[model samples]
Target: MSPRTGVRLVTIFSAVVLAFFLFGDWLARRDAPEPLAWYETYRESLWQPIQDRSLTLLQADQALGRGHLWMISADGEPALVSRYNLESDDRLWQAQAVIGLGAEEMESLVEAQAWEPGIRDQPVSPAVGEALGDRQILRMSMIPVEPLELNRIEGTFGSPDVRMPVSEGEAWVYPRAGAVVAVGEEEAFSIMFGLRDES
Candidate 1:
């Protein structure tokens, strides 16, 4: 009402607004996430061990070249990601070919062929079969065989109790882990190492 009272109230309001802005700015700067090195990123932490091992094997055999590495977000956390071009990368194909199968055992895959049973039967190589059997799911970066090939793999495992879409692909889920393959014209590949639950 009074000029003096109005002036006092305006002064108080200005100071409060100034303080609020200053505090907010300070808090934002303090809580900002720090930039991480390639190895320290979340994707790296999750996938680096496999990448390093693969690289080492390639290096030891004198076939190592520039390997691919990139960053991705996993469950809202920063993560490092890498994938091998299965159809193109000879070294990777060789390494993955030998992951759990011997040379003869690897050749056994030729005998395994996708067949259609009452439900449907997909044939998988012994190496793929063994990896599928042991790990129950491939790692995130492993190349996906063709869908027909994958379907046969799933058929070998029996139909998934529950199948659902994750992102742009479908996931054939099992009890312990889930198999997700991205199917699209642009990206028609499967991650042999399916996405696992962090829980």
Candidate 2:
């Protein structure tokens, strides 16, 4: 091709490339995610266990309502719970034995007792429910209850008459003001655990 023609083609190509880049930037700017306080709260709640415990045991934050966020470890170990109140930017959580125990502790427990997940599986029944402190705890047969997600009385707080089930599960038990639920911009909801129904 002639030198003049070559120069013209190169100039046109460069202009097209520059225009595409500038337009792309503008498009991205328009479609970017908004910076919402909820998002920041979500991200902050996600990193709590990572900061307090090990990231390897990080689990899914299943509960997201009002303004609070909850996450549970897969192994039914202690869960990383967090409550985010946007009104005043308040956050709280419980990181110890939320589900089970640490990996090392769990390993030791299993090695010492020959206990493990599914080593002995039993249907969740009302008797078991009573043991869990919920006298009315009805065992919804085959209701898709994850054995690990089920809540039980930890030896730490349960009665001495009944030995705590050395297994995995979770209890969404909260007192009147334990689980904070923020609604809209100003409303709030709270739950408080009362005396265990022994009936």
Candidate 3:
């Protein structure tokens, strides 16, 4: 092969590699979920119950098998009692107890827990009847709540529990205006707890 031909081939290969890298980077950034203010509010609200119950957010990986954003322990015994996730700038969460703890305590607990080690695991659906609250709560036995892509609304359910005939392995649950949400069949939809005004 001639030196000129070799140099031209090398240049073409470099251009292709550069283009691939640029395209991958742009797609990753575009697919990233949007930041949500409600996530902060909802996180604080969910942690309130744990603090109120005197449970501590463990520094260990408490939620290994159980799929949830945060995990807490009462008396050093870790239990997956709460669930939280962020989708499309919206927050979804579900807890065993109501979230009405004092703001100061919740804030402090959240701050302390922030420094704790994170638990990485696949998202899991909450168990049936585990999400007890004042309002209506249902379990999605058909669909399993899996993470969804940014701005993608496929296989998602909306707020207000409406009993309608759904195909097997397909269900949707939307978070109410003042309710707690637990991941159900899809990341976009989750099992919602009853609403309680903080004020």
Using TM-score, give the best candidate's number.
1
Off by over 4 Å in 2: 35-46, 50-84, 87-199
Q: What is the C-alpha lDDT of each candidate?
A: 0.39, 0.31, 0.37
Candidate 1's residue-wise lDDT over 1-199, tens digit each?
A: 9999999999999999999999999998775543212113323333333333332323312222323432333454322222334343221231121123344543443234321223222323234332332221124434534333444334334455566666666665543333343444334354333334444
Estimate, for each residue in 93-161, the C-alpha lDDT of model 2 and write its tens digit: 222112224467446534544444434422222232122221110100011111211112121122223
The residue ranges of model 1 lying beyond 4 angstroms of the native Cα positions read 1-67, 73-77, 87-139, 145-150, 165-169, 182-188, 192-199
Q: Measured by TM-score, how close is model 3 to the native structure?
A: 0.28
Each candidate structure's count of clashing pairs:
10, 14, 7
> lDDT tens digits, residues 1-199, model 3?
9999999999999999999999999998886545433334444433333323332322111321223433344344322333423333333333332233345644554454442334432222343213322221121111113444324332132233533335433343333333333333544344333333344
Per-prediction TM-score to the true structure, in the order listed: 0.30, 0.24, 0.28
Q: What lDDT is reached at residue 12 by model 3? A: 100
Please tell me which model should have the higher TM-score, number 2 or number 3: 3
lDDT ranking, best first: 1, 3, 2
Candidate 2 local accuracy as lDDT?
0.31
Best by lDDT: 1
